[model samples]
Target: MSQFAGLAVELEESGVKHEMITYSGAPHAFTVFGSDRYREDADKKSWMAFTGFLEEKTGVKAM
Candidate 1:
């Protein structure tokens, strides 16, 4: 299963309101704003921040 799918399942099981938002046909490396920008460092940072935010908000570790 995809990471997104697993995360959605976990969040649902935790009774947290969550949605998987995706832009169909968009490249994996693309930014959320669709800027065609790819930055490995920034992506890692963003992912960490997002995960931290989710944990803080939901009191659940996504992983």
Candidate 2:
């Protein structure tokens, strides 16, 4: 996690656009279906974040 934070900081320092969204206590594969660790809220949140990121970079809203 520190590495990710460091990367985010580095990106900011280098003037690159970036965003980070962390789901606290979300286990691995939290977005995968049929997994015991799957979380509906986290899955939805992750997809929304991903779509938003894509839209923010590409200027096209996802359907």
* Most TM-score-accurate candidate: 2
Flag clash pairs in model 1: none
What's the CA RMSD of model 2 in angstroms?
Answer: 2.3
lDDT of 1 by residue, 1-63 (tens): 398898998999999986566545445765555466665556666677789889999999978
lDDT of predicted model 1: 0.71
Tens digits of per-residue lDDT, candidate 2, 1-63, equal: 898799999999999976677898788789889988999998998999889989998999999
Cα displacement (angstroms), candidate 2, residue 23, comes to: 0.6
Residue 40 Cα positional deviation in candidate 2, in Å, after optimal superposition: 0.6
The candidate scoring highest on lDDT is 2
Off by over 4 Å in 1: 1-36
Q: What's the count of clashing pairs in each model shown?
A: 0, 0
What are the lDDT scores of the predictions, listed in order?
A: 0.71, 0.88
